[model samples]
Target: MPPDYPYGDKVSEPISAYAKRIGIKHETVRTQCDKGILPIIQRKKGTKREVNLYALYLRAKYKAEQFIRDFES
Candidate 1:
C-alpha cells in the first residue's frame, strides 16, 4: 500500500503520476521540480525524485486561501 499523508493522497509520488492526478502536464510538474518550485524527495544521487504531495497540497491550499482572502477584501 502507498504511504498516507495527513492532508490527502500519497505521501509522495512520481512527477508524472502527480501531474496526471492533478490534470496537468508532466513537463510542467517537471519544470517546477527542476526549478525548486515544488517540494521533492531525492533518495540519493542519480535516483528518481519523488514529488512531496503533502507539501504541494499544503502550499496550494495556502495559496488558494490567500487568493480568496484578497478577493474578499
Candidate 2:
C-alpha cells in the first residue's frame, strides 16, 4: 500500500504517469527511482512503485537552486 501523505490525500502514482506529466521518459524516471534519487513508495513487497509529488517538488527546487548557482558563477 502507498503512504498517506499530508498533501491533501494526493500521495503518489506510478512512475510512468509521473514521467508523462513531467515530459520525461518513463525509463529515466524508473532509473531515478531505482537509484533512490527520487522518493517512492513500494507496494506489495516492491512489486509496485509509486513516486511522491512532494519529493519531485523538492527535487525541482533543488535543481532551480543549482541553476541559479551556475548562473552566478
Candidate 3:
C-alpha cells in the first residue's frame, strides 16, 4: 500500500474529498480522469494516483442559474 493513499503524506485532503464536495460521484471522477477531462493522474508507487489540485473546472452551474434568472425577469 502507498504511504500516501486515501490521504497523502503531503495533503490532508484527498481527490475523492474534492470531487465529492463538488457534487461529482467518486466513480465518475475516476472515469473522467481516465477520459482525460480531469487532470492526468500521476502514478504513485503501490498503485496510488495523484491529481493536480490546481486544475480548475469550468463550472457552469452558477451561469445556468443566472441565465434562468435573466430569462425569467
Candidate 4:
C-alpha cells in the first residue's frame, strides 16, 4: 500500500518542491540560496540541504496576499 505513507513525521522534500510550496520558483530558490540570501547547505547530490521553513512560509504567505490584492481590485 505505497509503504503505508503519511503515517508519521514526513521526510523533508526536495528543494524544488520546497520552493514551490513556498511561492518561489525552483530556479529563484536555487539562485537566492546560491547568492547566500538564504543560508543553505549542500547535500551529497549537490542540492540545497536545509532551508528556513518559517522564512519560506512567511514569503509564501506575503506573496499570496499580494497576489490576491493585486487581482482583487
Candidate 5:
C-alpha cells in the first residue's frame, strides 16, 4: 500500500480529499470521475464519488497508457 495514500492509506477516498492529497484542483478529480476515466464507486445514493486509491496510484504511476486504452476501447 502507498504510504501517502489520501487519509493514510485508505482504500477509497472522496474526490475533494484525493485532490487535496495530490495537490490538484478538486474539480479536476470530479471531472475525471464524472467522465468515467477514473475508477470510482458511488457511496450510497446521491452521495459524492469515492475513488479507489490503488487504482489511482496505478494510473498515475503508469500515466497516459490508461487514457489511451480508455479512449480506444
Candidate 6:
C-alpha cells in the first residue's frame, strides 16, 4: 500500500470515499462506474456502491507498468 493510502486495511470502500481519497470528484467516480470503467459492486439492499480497492490498486499498477514500457520503447 502507498504511504498515503486512506482507509487503512480496507479491502472495499464506498465510491464517494474512494473518490475523495484519490482527490477526484465523487460524480466522476460514479460516472466511471456507470460506464463500466471502474470495477464496482452494488450493495445487496441499498443504492450504495463500493469499489474493490485491491482491484483498483492492481489496475493502477498495471497501467503504470504499461506506461513505463511504452516510454522505454
Q: Give a tens-digit lDDT track for model 5, residues 1-73.
A: 6665544657788788888978999999888888888899786889777888778767776776778888999
RMSD of each: 4.5, 6.0, 9.8, 8.7, 6.2, 3.4
lDDT comparing candidate 2 with the true structure = 0.82
Candidate order (lDDT): 1, 6, 2, 5, 4, 3
Highest-TM-score candidate: 1
Query: Candidate 6, overall lDDT?
Result: 0.84
> lDDT score, residue 22, model 1?
85
Worst 10 residues of 6 by lDDT: 1-10
Instruction: Please estimate how well model 3 matches the true structure, expressed as its whole-model Cα lDDT.
Output: 0.57
Summarize candidate 6's per-residue lDDT along 5-65 as a digit string, tens digits.
Answer: 5447887888888899889999999999889898987768567889887777778878989
Predictions ranked by TM-score, top down? Answer: 1, 6, 2, 5, 3, 4
| TM-score of every prediction relative to native | 0.65, 0.61, 0.46, 0.42, 0.59, 0.64
- Model 4, residue 11: distance off in Å is 9.6
* Model 2 residue pairs with clashes: none
Which segments of model 5 are wrong by more than 4 Å? 1-9, 57-73
For candidate 1, what is the TM-score?
0.65
Q: Over the stretch 10-61, how does candidate 1's per-residue lDDT look in tens digits?
A: 6799989989988999999999999999999989989999998778777877
lDDT value for model 4: 0.63
lDDT of 4 by residue, 1-73 (tens): 1343331343345568768777978888777777888655456675546655545555666898999999998
Query: So what's the TM-score on candidate 2?
Result: 0.61
The prediction achieving the highest lDDT against the true structure is 1
Q: Candidate 1 — worst ten consecutive residues by lDDT sum? A: 1-10
Question: Comparing 1 and 2 by lDDT, which wins?
Answer: 1
lDDT of each: 0.84, 0.82, 0.57, 0.63, 0.79, 0.84
State the weakest 10-residue window (summed lDDT) of model 4. Answer: 1-10
Which of 2 and 5 is ahead in lDDT?
2
Worst 10 residues of 3 by lDDT: 4-13
lDDT of 4 at 32: 78
